[model samples]
Target: MNTGSETQMGIIPPLFCIKCGLEHRLPILIMTAITEQAIQDCMTQIRQKQEPHHSLEIQKYAQLRLMDFAPLLGEWGIDDPKNTPKAKPLPNVAQAFQAAELSAEQKSKLLNYLQQAAKQGSTTAMLYLAYAYAVGKFIAQNPTKAVECARIALKHQDYRAARLLGEMLAFAPALASDVLQNDVQIAAQNWVKTHPKLAQNAEQIPQLITQYLHNPIVAKFVAKQKLQQAKTMGSPIADQRIRGLSMIGVLSSSQPARQYQSIENWLENQLAAAHMPIESDDDMMILPEHMPLMVQEDDDVPVWHKAAIVGGFLLSGAMITLLIIRFLVK
Candidate 1:
């Protein structure tokens, strides 16, 4: 009985007004029926894939698998379409950096690409540019520019940049007085404003700054601090920095010596309880010789526990003395 747009079963009925039972609208009626053949024809057209021209499109396609578009492809009835155009691969930050040794024109081209990517709001590109500026890699070192780039990334809500900025503020002596004189604590305070949980305790600010100062970036800063102090003051620990970095009253502690001693005692007690020798040779008890002398400055000390340095010495000394007394009696 159905003349137009027949499904496998039958023609679909047109929507009608329930109360009036008015005759069906022609356009609405026409739209009601969709046959299997129509679906197949629509799918055939969708399967006729066209290649993309834009570089961004190509990059996006290459980075994301075709399967990611499965839902859209399915809806369009496109499957296994060929000749999906791929864009030429852009060199990553590392590649571009290494290619700095190439000819001037080539390097310049690469730098331009990176700059464009940064301008386009690529956080990765911004970070690489920041690093290049910070370390003088393939470009004249400019810490100010590096900091600026890092700040830009932070504005974009990049947590890596936030941590990096923290490191720069805490460790970089070039920035210590000029930029970070009061900024470290101020920055932390600002951060705490939004992330209120970080400021739940009174000690959180100092604790957070301490963690930042312990980052790998601060290693160079700590070493430089030690060297400068050793040359001028002839004492490494005499300076307040080794006590722990402080600015604007955050991370400033007067009792680092006592705190360090307590840590040393706790670590020694733990090791003694375990009966583990402090060094490879079980007989040696001279803790100072075995333990590193560069305590405050050295960040990469082999001992995992900060207290272990002093604690190991005391524990080893006590053990050796006991052994010596036993030998003398024998």
Candidate 2:
């Protein structure tokens, strides 16, 4: 055994630290049998000391590795805490496919990964895959799949998915399967009931209405519902549009000439009766002969002031006319 090489020593098994779940390979072992609680306490103290460094590492990884997905997530307002290794993790399959830098093979691989993730019940992955299917990003265009993904997201409480579903139902109803048609209708009806209270919500309502107007399956109903909604909201412009849409069939038929004329006349009267926009204080410019034009500081100018100015102008015009007439007579 002592022939030439040094005598071999037994190898020690790695010590698994229970607290931090890391294995420690020590070259030497102290015979002292430390309690498991003592080991855990020691590990916990070590981890506490290393927490800041670990956080720094995670932050660096997210900032450096996930820069591409940052803007995309910010746009969606998705909350992605840096607690996990994933950053701004949302549905980005379509975005990845559409990126100019990815090769065909890379896109294929990425798509496969996304599909797997989606199937594993990743809501964000599903949403992204749905859009990819809808637009035929890297895969063949499949509206059916897009609708399915959107429905799944909606079922999972993604309100934005409901919006996508509403849009598909309203603008491209033909693309929906017959089995899903009634479901689409029901979803759309529910969507119409939404009352927008935020700035973003208000902005999205008009887009939804536009899609509803294009829906061949329920154009008339959509228009009618919008008309009522706008009226309740006190929007004159919306009222005008809905009324015009309702008359499309009547205006195109000679048999409904009277109805068309009646509707036209009513519209005209409505427009005439609507008040003109009053000039705001900012818009009201008053100029004195010797000074620069001064905008009114108050929101409203006195009605009597306007009346007095008009009367003065009219009186001056009458005086000029009377003098001219007298001179001609003379």
Q: What is the TM-score of each candidate against the true structure?
A: 0.30, 0.32
Which portions of model 1 show Cα errors greater than 4 Å? Answer: 1-91, 169-171, 177-330
Task: List lDDT for all candidates, in order.
Answer: 0.41, 0.42
**Top lDDT: which candidate number?**
2
What's the CA RMSD of model 2 in angstroms?
Answer: 29.8
Backbone clashes in each candidate structure, one number apiece?
0, 0
How does candidate 1 score on lDDT? 0.41
lDDT of 2 by residue, 1-330 (tens): 001112222212222222332222123332322232333443354446533222211221111221132322332345434211221255455456447566779877887887787677665666676666655456654445676786676566544454344434433333323214344334433333341121122223233333333334443233244334434433324345445544664112122222122222222222223322333468584433223234668787799999999999999999999999999999
lDDT of 1 by residue, 92-207 (tens): 54555644366668757766876887787765566666666555455554455666786676566543444444444433422432223133444444444554432344233343
lDDT of 1 at 127: 62
Candidate 1, which ten residues in sequence have the lowest lDDT sum?
78-87
Angstrom error of the Cα, residue 89, model 2: value is 3.2
